[model samples]
Target: MIRVRGTVGAWPVDLQIELDDQDWAALARQASAEPATTAAAAARPSGDDPLWSRAQALLREAGELEGPELLAALAALAGSDQAGKRLLVRLRHCDQVEIVQRGEAPLYRWIAQ
Candidate 1:
């Protein structure tokens, strides 16, 4: 059984699929046929990813922005709050980003490399 729960374009999605033995075998076969490099490349995020590139570009263009404000923009771009939050977390840990506490809020600044 495969369960997927997430949002797609502002819509919440919850799905479950139960696969039989044959289906599982077929899936395993397809996965094993793929090149190891392809799987590894897909798992790692890169500038080639559109959402990641755009998220970085948005922060770069802003120079600096408050956490909530930047999160709202990212949420809009990502089409869901959860997705936006994921991007925000990534930005918080990014080498090019500097985070500072201002009162109760966080300020995210893009440091040019």
Candidate 2:
């Protein structure tokens, strides 16, 4: 069984799709067949931009969020000289920080200490 959830306006909806073992196995095999290449993997940033690094560390530590949400959050935070306003907004919504914006930009410091 597969369960999916999404929101419409202010309401939330869920859907469940059930499959037999054979069908499940086929789906798993299909997924496993398409592995990301090394260059594609390496295109992701690996660095000390605090927000990107912190977000990555948090994701690793929490082991939650996947697919587009994960990608959007990561892309929002990554590959910038500093974490900007939009990334700050995303991070704040995730409860990752208490942010302060100066004009159109974000100035990030550690959340508490």
lDDT for each residue of candidate 2 in 30-92, tens digit (9 for 90 to 100): 777766676566765445557756674655554554333544555665654244434545555
C-alpha lDDT of all candidate models, in order: 0.94, 0.58
TM-score of 2: 0.30
lDDT of 1 by residue, 1-113 (tens): 99999999999999999999999999999989998899999877776779988999999999999999999999999999999999999999899999999998899999976
Backbone clash count for every predicted candidate, in the order shown: 0, 0
- Which run of 10 residues does model 2 get worst, by summed lDDT? 104-113
TM-score of each: 0.61, 0.30
Assess candidate 1 and give its TM-score to the true structure: 0.61
**What stretches of model 2 exceed 4 Å from their correct place?**
36-113
Highest lDDT scorer: 1
